[model samples]
Target: MKTKNRILQTALELFNEKGINEVTLRGIALNVGMSQGNLNYHFRTKSEIVSELYYNLVEEMDEAMKKITLDQPVFSLLYESSLVSMNILYKYKFIAQDLHSVLESNSELKVHYLALQKMRKQQFLFLFQNMIAEDLMRKEELKNEYERLYERMNILGDNWINSANLFFQERSSKVAHYHSLLFEVIFPYLTQKGKEQYLKSL
Candidate 1:
């Protein structure tokens, strides 16, 4: 691996083991077996690395979402996307652990996070609309609850890792466990046919 990529990868591991505030650039340098000056050549500050990793996470999620098709069952897409989301969350666990503080530490990252939140809102809205059209969800019921449902999903998606870590020391490591909880939030709202299809998916 190139020096820059190695630094980022090593830094991610350190940050995951320790919160962003607790890990220092020097520690990352030592862990990677790179001199302080050499690490500095790539990332002058830890915040710089954090921002890059955040964007990298966003890029990965976008790539995963791009693979979904309108023809695919919503539950199947949810099943696959949940794994992708969990993998990214694990890769950048520090951010999820202390998302507010990490974003507050950097002005640019805060702005990007706000933009990403908006994008996520739109994406969820589109997903719901598609499911309604496909007869997988009840449009009449969802029309009044879109905002509330999205809020629940956002809470679970964003904080599931932290919650799971607290509740399940061993099971938290499994992506499918987290994904199942996330999928369950929308399950009750599904039509009978939708529920059958979703069950068949498993």
Candidate 2:
């Protein structure tokens, strides 16, 4: 692998194994078997490496999102998307694990992340509209009900790693377990036909 890619991979492993705050650029260099100055030649600081990794994660998710379409049943699309997202998050588990601190300390990343989230929120709204039109999702009983549901999903999606690390004894199933929980947020809002379709999917 190229030196730059190796640095990022090694840094990701170190960050995931040790907390991001706990792993310094020097530590990453040592892990990569390179001199600190050489590592600095590739990345000036830890935050720079982190910014690259963050964008790398976003790029991967964007690529995955491109594969999904509205042609499938609503629940199945959601389940597939959730599983894909969980797998990506698991690969870069440190990001979700240290999200608050990582964003809080990096102003540029925080701005980009907030903007990305806004786009995702809009996408979810569009999905809800489509599902309602198809009679697969019930009309919102209250104003912004599905908006709130999206927020709840956001919370769970971003923080489930912490819960899994603390409560789950079997590491292998953590992604699957949390993927189901995250996808379940919309279950109550599904119409009868939707429920039937979703059951058939299972």
Candidate 3:
């Protein structure tokens, strides 16, 4: 990798192993075998590195979601998307924490983040609507239920990610028990046969 890319990659690994506050430019430089001045030339501040990591994460997620075609079963798409998202969380836990911290501290970033979240929810809702229109869902009533379910799921997912980070910091079990919990909560809303199939696949 290029020197700048190597530094960013090493920094992300260090941040994930240690919290953002614990990571320093000097440490990153040492890890990359470069000078602190060279690291600073590529990324002026830790916050800049955090921001770039966030953008890369979002891009990765978008790319993953794009690969899930509309022809796929809704339940399958959702399950796979959940897995992809969870993988990102596991790999970039520190970047996720940095985003949470930044949003907590800066109203502007919070607003932007919320808007992005709203857009995501709307996209999910649209996907649900399409499934309903195609007779893929179990019931028409599910259309309304999905909106509520989606919002609740998002909240649950955020909490799960945060909890995972805390547990990781404390050297707790590596198993992600919350994923199964999430699958159970969401399985009920799938079409009857679809729910059975999804659970079986799991």
Q: Which candidate number would show the highest TM-score if scored against the true structure?
A: 2
Give model 2's TM-score versus the native structure.
0.96
Sort order, TM-score high to low: 2, 1, 3
Please give, for residues 1-202, the per-residue lDDT of candidate 2 as tens digits.
9999999999999999898989999999999999999999999999999899999999999899899885876677888888988899888999999998999999999999999999999999999998889888999999899999899999999999999999896767898788888877787999998888878766
Find the 10 residues in a row with the least total lDDT in model 1: 167-176
Candidate 3: deviation at residue 180, Å? 2.4
Alpha-carbon RMSD of each model: 2.0, 1.2, 3.5
Clashes of 2: 0
Q: What are the per-residue Cα lDDT tens digits for candidate 1 across 63-144?
A: 8778766466678777877777787777787888889898788888889888888988898888888888888888765355
Worst 10 residues of 2 by lDDT: 70-79
Comparing 2 and 3 on TM-score, the stronger one: 2
Model 3: colliding residue pairs:
none
Error in Å for residue 139 of model 1: 3.2
Please tell me which predicted candidate would have the highest lDDT against the true structure.
2
Question: Which residue segments of model 3 deviate by more than 4 Å?
Answer: 105-112, 131-146, 165-176, 190-194
Give all TM-scores, in the order shown.
0.90, 0.96, 0.79
Which of 1 and 2 is the better model by lDDT? Answer: 2
- How much lDDT does each candidate structure score? 0.83, 0.91, 0.73
